[model samples]
Target: MAFDIYDFTSLTSSIHEGLATFLPPVGVLIAEWLLVGISVLLFVAVFGLILVYLERKVCALFQQRLGPMRVGKWGLLQTIADFIKLLMKELITPNKADKFLYNLAPFIVIIVTFMAIAAIPFAKGLQAIDFDIGVLYVSSVSSLGVIGVLLAGWSSNNKYSLIGAMRSGAQIISYELSVGMSLITMIILAGSMQISEIIQAQSTGWFIFTGHIPAVIAFIVFLIAGTAETNRGPFDLAEAESELTAGFHTEYSGIKFAFFFLAEYVNLFIVSAMATVLFLGGWMPFHVGSLDGFNAVMDFIPPIFWFFGKVMFVIFLIMWFKWTFPRLRIDQILTLEWKYLLPVNLLNILLMTLIVLMGWHF
Candidate 1:
């Protein structure tokens, strides 16, 4: 049978239907759900490795040095070697640590990231889960990682760990407002919180184009706040290695440490994916009404390609910030969020409201 790359739901439905013919109904259902989970897990694992390598290469390029080149073809297998080393390392806990919470934090972080990416559509009709309030659901679930961070810090019985966790909590809570408000500016314009629907609304033009300057401003705020929300530098006060000695996860080690490490990159993926879906147009190719040939050429590239292209671009932007900017002081981070981002986001939303009401978009 011919496959339609864009009609992902249809393909999955077909597979489920075919399996149901041989397998018991319960087995088919279980298999389908399990496959979905496995696919997402694999994506997270692979993306985490790729992101680590990419960041190293980017940092090397900026610093005029060689990155991982000996492990595999151009150091492609370097992350794999590092993963093996991390996987075999010891899982240590402090003598006075609260065992339960200290052990559970990393799992919580990983689970939240898995839940978040499920709501994000990679291609048309390709999300693992669908909800009317996709935006709200993703935001709420993703923010719950802070609980794990706080627990990890507090349960470690280390004053430094506690300090790091508190800083993380403050930073995430502060920046998330900017992230949500910035996204909402475009959501208000899109008039739907369903992520796929949001992308569909951008068929003629992306929010970055349709909503114009307000959309551009919203994207910038989201990028900055989203970076902070992920505990990434220059907003990486939570895990300030120079200050707190690895932040909330300082007391964590081994496979447990790997979980926290993976979650950080996965969180980065979540924000970048959301940016693609919300502002840059998820799975939507660039098109111009006046350029039939150009639009046709773009259509040939496929939706999945468009999705990843935009996501990678945003990820690169985040990495650039991490490498180029100096880490902000805790006060400076809060000041940037509360004083600048929050106010600008509020005004951007207002401007979007006016533009939407006036039907200014094409």
Candidate 2:
């Protein structure tokens, strides 16, 4: 087979075959599992630092102020310094907190993030696990993080923490419907839940363009719902610093707190990645009909870059929402979802179904 640096399939297959040649079948399985675990751990650690730095810079740009100039060139090492500090700090638990559940919450939250990340396709054949029900698998796993939030808050024995956790649970539960309906709308259009197949269906053109108005609506709803699901700002009633201090993880300190912090940025990445795969065509290069020259130029860029470029664009939009909007009142947040987004999302789903039935979509 011809080598393509952009596609990871050949590299991964060769590794597997080479290992099989020297190792027993069980040993091969064990080796692959070890490799995957280490890769995920390393990626999470490095990407978490990058995202924290990116968020600082992005927020600085919005506010017209310098960010992170003291640590390294342009303060690039700031997050790494902070990470090291967190690692050295003490993991403090509240004296009154339930020790077992309190300690378990952060692990639960971060583990769910890793599980959801496994299903996302970073590039061709680069995914850790590819289930037929990839979308459903992701949705189910990602939603479990809220349980950890609740556990942290309730186990802390703090009223503020409990309130924040309760708020997060309600917020995530409500907005999840909008997120699912948006994906279902696309699934109706694409006719597959497998993430790879969904991307392949966009070989000619992205669904956002081909599916037209309904696709646009679903995209909007998905972004809004995704932000809410991640407990991010504008919908961050759960983490109202003025009202609830540090919210659900208030009692957590040191590396435990870092886990929660890391999970937030990683969750942000996952949400953007899902948006990219569903509406922005995953790793597929952009193409305009009958423009072979332009299409060929686009294809010259690696698929992995296309995938991450789209992911970063969507991440910026989510970050913009975070920095720009005022946090909504808890009631307003719930009302926005139940009254406005949810109803519009339900209608949008029906519209997409009709479009599919009538063959109106490209």
Candidate 3:
């Protein structure tokens, strides 16, 4: 029972062994599964609320307005108030809408957002599921949100919803190409798609630095592509109220509308987390070469701090774009994707390949 590394290891081994046997039992397994499901649901719900509040505050700072200060301390309870309002609102469906699909679409979108979290590495030895192709798994699962958006838009049987869905589909598909290619470059350098391995590889030197010029280019491309992929800010054509009258979920109301709103912010969080893993060194501590004192000082901070700092930086940038820029025309959006991001990302990948082959990393 003495405090030692082996003692901790033995405890973990014993727990794992016990779970291996216990999980096969009918009653215990069902209870454990329910507990896990509840935990995930609660986490998503809380995170969605916090993200909404954070986005509002961040935007207000940029625009020089007081954001939600009337509710709770510093508007801490703003999301809670909004939740109450949404809960009390009457559910409305368009007369011509297909009830089943319209009703199901929001849930599908929200569920897919939750599923994407399964592959994200929150901290050392902390993840819901660790698959071999972790990055690819995340990409595949996250993209399914588009299907829900398209379903919501088309099934609503409204002209605006249909157009929003079509715009969203095109936007996601186009941006996914650059996002995938940029992530692949990191996978190439790390030689693995597992999130933990990617973070481990960055211990000596983050890929953003080790991968050099090509990595920098890929990072920029990934940020732009990720923004577009989530249908956020300048790329938020899907919800362009001015043009599409609330876009894909225009016909949705009450709790169903809340689902779409929650899904959008959750998707934003996922993309930001992914970017931190790929380019900003995930949970790795800051290290300056040959500066042992500085490195040691930095290591005192918890790994989760590094992770959140990076995520927040990206979130702030997204908010800046949202408040500062006008929404792009659909045609201009497509043109920006095909004419710029695709070609630049392709060349950047080729450059990374050459750099890797030449063994130029320090």
Candidate 4:
């Protein structure tokens, strides 16, 4: 069989077949899920470390200095070293903290991240789950992480932690409206909520182009709101060191703290991946509707490459925002969501609806 990096279904099916020769059907199924879960966990760890390294380098570059040059060649393994250190650190809880909820919060946060990730489509037929309401499932389920944040703060008995948690809850709740509306604008054009269907609809041209101005508006809004949703810098009021001093997870340490840290970067990838699926066409290559030759060249590049490229671009854009912009005040954060993003998002949806109704989309 020819190698096809873009399509993992066949390879995985073949493996499943080999396993099935010795195992029951139920065991095969359980094995598939377990293997995928392990892969995703590894991805979370590796990508989180990569992001930390990238952000540090980006920050250092802006400041005209070398970043992380000590450990392994250019300090590439700095984060890994930190991970080991964290593993050995003591898991400390405040004397007055709620022992149960304080311990449970980090797991809750990380679990929700993986739960939402299960729905993401990586490439053609490269999805774990394909619920008919995949997009809705992602947007709704992902927001539940805020509950973990809230619980962490309220359980910590630290006023700073409580304040940070409250800020994050309000920020995520407010921006979720813009994120959903922006995605809905794309959904209206695609006429489906399934991630695969959304990508299929964009085989010829991405929604960012087909939906035109409204699509552009939605894309920009989604990027902004989604960045805020992840509690990243510029919108990182929830974890402002100058203010809340490590924010909601301030009381956490050791592996529990590691979960919170890793979950944040995983959340970053989740939002970026969703943006890729909703606006950038998921795994679709760039192609004009009637240009066969051009499309053939684009197709030759492979679907997974296109998907990875777009996801990385969106992730870079978010990282750029983090390094370039200063953190906003709490009031400014709320105002941006309530006064600007929400209104603009609502109107953009209305415009998209009109365009769809008028059959103006290509």
The TM-scores of all predictions, comma-separated, are 0.98, 0.98, 0.93, 0.96
lDDT of 4 by residue, 1-362 (tens): 33467687787777778889998999998999899899788878888888888778877887788999998999998899999999999999999999999999999999999998899888877788899999999999999999999999999999999999999999999999989999899999999998888888988789998899999999999999999999999999899999899999999999999999999989998999999998888989898878899888988887888887898899889988988899999899988888998889889889999999999988
Query: Of the candidates shown, which would achieve the greatest lDDT relative to the real structure?
Result: 2
lDDT per residue (tens digit) for residues 161-238 in model 3:
999999999999988898899999888888899888898899887788889898889888888889998898799998
TM-score of 3: 0.93
Cα displacement (angstroms), candidate 1, residue 201, comes to 0.4
Clashing pairs in 2: none
RMSD of 3: 2.8
Q: Over 4 Å off in model 2, which ranges?
A: 1-3
- True-vs-predicted CA distance for residue 356, candidate 1, Å: 0.2
What TM-score would you give candidate 4 relative to the actual structure?
Answer: 0.96
Ranking by TM-score: 2, 1, 4, 3
Off by over 4 Å in 3: 1-32
lDDT of each: 0.91, 0.94, 0.85, 0.90
Residues 80-99, model 2: lDDT tens digits: 99999999998888888899
Compared with the true structure, what per-residue lDDT tens digits does model 1 show for residues 1-362? 33689677788888888889999999998998999999999999999999989989988987898899999999999999999999999889999899999999999999999999999898876898889899999999999999999999999999889999999999998888998998799899899999889999998888898889999999999999999999998988788889889988998888899899999999999999999999988999999878989998998988998999999999999999998999999899888988999998898899999999999977
- Candidate 2 local Cα displacement, residue 257, angstroms: 0.5
